[model samples]
Target: MTTATPHHLPGTDLALEQLPKVSLHDHLDGGLRPATIVELAADAGVELPTTDADELGAWFAEKSNSGSLVEYLKTFDITTAVMQTREGLERVAREFVEDLAADGVIWGEIRWAPEQHLARGLSLDETVEAVQEGLEQGVDAARNAGHRIRVGQLVSAMRHADRGLEIAELALRHRDAGVVGFDIAGAEAGFPPSRMRDAFELLAANFFPATIHAGEADGLDSIRGALTDGRALRLGHGVRLAEDIEVSTEGDGQVARLGRLAEWVKDRGIALETSPSSNLQTGAIAQWGTTLADHPLDLLYQLGFRVTVNTDNRLMSGTTLSRELALVADEFAYDLDDLLVFQLNAAEAAFLPVEDREALADAIIEGFEKAR
Candidate 1:
């Protein structure tokens, strides 16, 4: 069993936190610090199960460990409830970046659905601006703390809602500001990417990139819809794509075969945002097992898929990118070289420009080389 006490992998210390990293699939709402959540919830008059930060953090960990997506999603109510107004959103975004910087993230793209934050009378544009303001503040704070961190917003439209086009335009409006990309999140089963065709069309016409929450709560057809209808450049929790891969045992190792869809994702180098803890929490990898060892990340990595490690929700999953990599390393027995590949995958798949992507890659390579 995994211990509750957090410890670094053998010979790695906490050095992984010092290794420059790029995060492509982190969620702003999913990553509030526990103490900050307590303060924000109190100010926003949001009721939480516990006021103690440690207990609150443990509550999130316990709830998400239930191995059901429904149970896992219930924890978000508190986080998003306090995030309804401008202050709540700004503080959370700002602290999110601070926490990422402390975790050694050099670059991160935070995704959140603005439509969900409109409940407190904030317009879609207002919500985006508030988040941008917080992101800038976080960047300044990181710089002051001597940790250089760059963050971008990925505006998400709740697929269950019908405001995709409006959210898409909001993303476009802030493209030059703090917004970097677009995404479709929430209820990935019935509300397929096809349901947001108008929004994807607008984003595509505007030459904006998108990453859809596919292959998580749904199957291969959902992934297909994400690629075809949403025109997703990356796959969120695309772990289920392993369902399309057939593994046959050989003498010592295994031989694998990929379906056409999996082949396309592999050949195109579409990034797979594999979050170990959150994937298990959401039952996204239930077909495999209830353990990290059952995660198909190793299979996908071996097959040359662009697999990047992430913490879908830091609070909910009770994880950091360092912790996620440690868990995967433990399960897969991966060394420093393997971890560097994951960082490089995320750096390459980042929504930054070509030159910036190269720079991020260089940073990751340098960090890994030092660790080795």
Candidate 2:
């Protein structure tokens, strides 16, 4: 299921797919290969609306673009159904890495809710093991293909569910087995991270890192709880944090004033995992506009926030790391240096050890310098 490297873009001389990158917020379930999904569905006796890969891909895009969160979430239902078995999860996870490597991602964090995969009778531990096995194989495959890539797992707990504590422990249990972090990612508005305070506390006590979904479907309050209660080291699509900043165009220069929350986030260097296309699909940037150009990423970037571009759901958004960066570059007039900064920001914010993170940063700098 590895994607072929795209050689050239339609109207540009640059091949964005050729640039080195880091993917910090990609989801394992959200990046499945369409053809694989169809095959898996047939094997599992699960029904698919469309069996053709091209049509199925369009179906995802159309449903996600419906601007309804409920409709968007329905897509995951199909993906998760086929992933009930160990084989399904392992294959998907392995292909996820191969696809990332083909897209030029040097490092990535693949997040998924292990709790959701137990419906077919797999234990929580088994689910993690399955995905970890896939990731290891994927890494080896990529290496054999002459592409160097590293990936880690971020086990997520469904926010509305009451298994946060269990999921947190599951993540910590497999800390040495490829699970690198914890997260709470379902509906973000009503189900704030505070609901999982005890889970976050356990992670904190265990010295486990976490990132929460905030500022996408919710506002600053969800973000506050993510930082204060969840102790999130990074935010999943924290795009709405822009609500806390006011930009005033004065006589000569523009004056940007940060609210207390914005000031705290910026000062603390909490990474904003902004996924532009997904944000638009989910109406996370409704206050701004209905296009990539209207995203507040540039503002956050200029204001010193640790802004990183991501493809929240590659299938739903019909995007890649390269396409997301191209979209942002077109919107913000970002040069190769700016693109390098985002990759470096993500590498620094990754849940790796300091030495490993430093290595990742060095790799990014070298790649970008070569590209320039």
Candidate 3:
């Protein structure tokens, strides 16, 4: 029905968008379509730098590529401004799932802070319900369009805000209603998860899963706090965990020695929700280098850390899960099996029940096999 050439995997004819994928770290507000933003801006009484869809999209990409996490985050102000109303949140959420489905993402976790969407006097409870309704609509829309996709919300609490526990309880309240996990996002350097010990403790007691954003803007200490205090089952952009790994020239070949923290993380199989493009844009991987080839993703994967690729912010990074995988494969020379492993790692790391995770993995394997 369409003549657009499919994006094939490098060195193979396999269509990249046809490959099954699991996205564990996509943000809701960060993935809004530029055209949708333009439409919503008018209704929300929000002005934009440019109303042209393509230019607005380019604006986000260029502004976010500033190589500073703080600077990169400034772009969110434009996105979240239009997402204050129920209609805006619902439309964004619905489109988010549809877009992921189009990108061959079989499953995804959409993270966004409810506290940030209250500017229009909508209650937190109302916002969560609105999002859930939209997500359900998205799943149906994707199904109708002949794409199979499942999505869940990972309600994020702004780390800089003092509403951690309140946000945690909000997630817990909606745990049975489409919400899958909890997370702490925004300005990760000064705001360690330890500061939200009460929130972590509450979620832990309730047997809820948390994936904290750590090791991105900070160092190993931040990751340590995530594990010890935040009890994070997964690290959001845990790229800095590579800092603890000491790699050296051992004559003919390289050797890597893991620090105690690194050892703990790898041994425990704590998932690293690493986003390559977002990491570079936010300077999360600056310590290693500026280029994608300099990313320690390969090193971490070689060391057997549970590494999972993600599109942290689709609009800002101008990426999808499929695009992220292609970038990684281009940099690392990964084959089909390697890409499958990344998807499986994310499947295991997903905050779903054992049976559900297993089912998800089975679906992924089947999809890859079909590709073969």
Top candidate, metric lDDT: 3
lDDT of 2 at 142: 88
Which tens-of-lDDT digit does each residue in 1-372 have in candidate 1? Answer: 011344465565655777788888888888988888899888878888989999999998998887776678778888899999998888888888888888889999999998888888998889999999998899899889889899999999988888899889999999999899999888777889888799999999999999999999999999999999999999999999999999999999888989999999999999999998899888999999988889899989988999999999988988888888888888898888888889999999999999999998998798778866
Candidate 2, lDDT over the whole model: 0.90
Best by TM-score: 3
Best-to-worst order by TM-score is 3, 2, 1
Clashes per candidate, residues 3 or more apart or on different chains: 0, 0, 0
Which is the better candidate, 1 or 2, if ranked by lDDT? 2
Sorting all predicted structures by lDDT, with the top scorer first, yields: 3, 2, 1
- Judged by lDDT against the true structure, how good is candidate 3? 0.93
TM-score of predicted structure 3: 0.98
Model 1 residue runs over 4 Å out of place are 1-7, 250-253
Model 2 spans with C-alpha error above 4 angstroms? 4-12
Give each model a TM-score: 0.96, 0.97, 0.98
